[model samples]
Target: MKDDEPEDTGSTLPRRQLGRLLREAREATGMSLEEAARLMEWGKSTLSRLERGKSERVRIRDVIGLCELFGTDEEKTAAIRELAEQAPVRSWWRSYGDVIAARFNTYLGLEAGASELAIFQPLIVPGILQTTDYARTLDRQYFSRDTDEELDRRVGIRMQRQHIITRQRQPVQLSVVLHESVLRTTVGSRQIMAGQLRHIADLSTRDNIQVRILPFRAGFPAGIVVSQFIIMSFPKDSRGKPVEPTVVFAESFTGDVYLEETGDVRRCRETFRTLQRATLDDRPSRDLMREIAREHDSER
Candidate 1:
């Protein structure tokens, strides 16, 4: 395989990858799920659910057992084990369970394993990079059942998700474009907004993260519809094909919609390019953020 060839990280879905890897290893050894379950002393149905990625959670012990039973080579075993370790203990957005929302959890799952993310946030800051204060303020305004604890939990998860950028192995490339309105709008108090803007300025300095701001001067473009969405891409598989379909996630007040068809993907890419053309470049965007911060400080 070429040095840049993407390994079959098992499942295209991050949450399901571990289970799929385990199943593949077991089957390669010509063992049935029941046989593997017996070797591991786990219930057959439990093993089956994991293989199907239907389980809500994955256990480390189960991963170790499957690895041993299948006698998987070191590389494959290590990859599967890593996925098992990286799996979230619970859905990050579970705190918002009472809210009527889309299946954002699935999106989060896919994002966890994505190689790159291109985001266009026309209304507000992207959730993964929002500071705690901004997140809490936005959550309170949007969610009716909000509480201090829930807000804190959600914000904490958002912060944790940012670690995907700094993680040792394969860090995700993040390119984000925010509307100029996002910088001008104060979601929280003046002090909080200033801090948030400063945070954005600092984050833009990171090598793996790119930030741009779309100016209002670029009036109603074809892409400036009422919707906001993100496009995610993963590394290609052994056959030089994307393991999972590239997805466009569009969010509404009521719920979210995911588009995976070829035409939709093309449209999303074209819209993103148009939005990029409308945006200020990175240096100017950071300058704009700093300027906003100064304005917020002066108002106080």
Candidate 2:
């Protein structure tokens, strides 16, 4: 990657890339965010959101003005202009906007760019690995206000995201640690849970995917007591240099919290290591999953 050119970060999502560019340009000007917002006649929150890649739409004219203010050269300015123009185009998830949370939309964008995903689930299956029937069952129970159409759309989004793991081109490396309770809990029905377990077993066979079971005998880690979380890492640039920093995602009833600080990321990584030490290896984990699936099938 060229020094001046933005690193690919494996993120083809142009809107996010555009946001990073704007933030970098502002910093190069050595102006505080408040000062820049004042000069641009924009609210501080708006500018902050734009810089953080939270905004869904960015104005091309504003990009031009900001590029000029930042003293960016003509060639670089034109490139940024093009990104701004493309930022408003709808991503595949845009059509499901009404069904999913706005915060989740941002997560989806980052997930698409990430090269590796390490997830730990204590209560249930992660959305990325959930079957359609299982997803529908969970969504219907949790989103009581949603109509059937909305529920279907939300499940569709989850199902589509699984492609990141199974797709032929640029498949992501996935490591999942599931608490044993996840297999024990009946999600939709005996049949549904059985299918979900079988699906997980199938996914574990893939070369790029690793699944482990954290049993009850091995006490739960303090770090995971808060809730389930996903840690995502983006690929290096063409020159094999680090591009995007690792991100830790935790979702709650209110919204999602993303931790990017080096210290925060270190803690999460360490916690994962602790969990891994207590987990059943892939082979045993697969066997246990199949065993559980058999129990569910018997009940069905």
Best by lDDT: 2
Give the per-residue lDDT of model 2 (tens digit) for 1-300.
012333333333456657777787889879889998899999999888777656766777888888888898766676577666653422212222322243225578688888889998988999999999999998999899999999999999999999999999889999999999999999989999999999999999999999999999988666437478888888777776555667778876666566665566677877887887899999999999999999999988
TM-scores of the candidates are 0.68, 0.69
- Per-prediction tally of clashes: 0, 0
* TM-score between candidate 1 and the true structure: 0.68
For model 1, the superposed segments whose C-alpha errors exceed 4 Å read 1-104, 144-146, 223-226
lDDT of each: 0.73, 0.78
User: Please, what are the lDDT tens digits per residue for candidate 1 over residues 175-242?
Assistant: 88888888888787888889999998898888888899888897766644736778877777677876
Instruction: Give the CA lDDT, 0 to 100, for residue 295 in model 1.
Output: 96
- Model 1: per-residue Cα lDDT at residue 257: 57
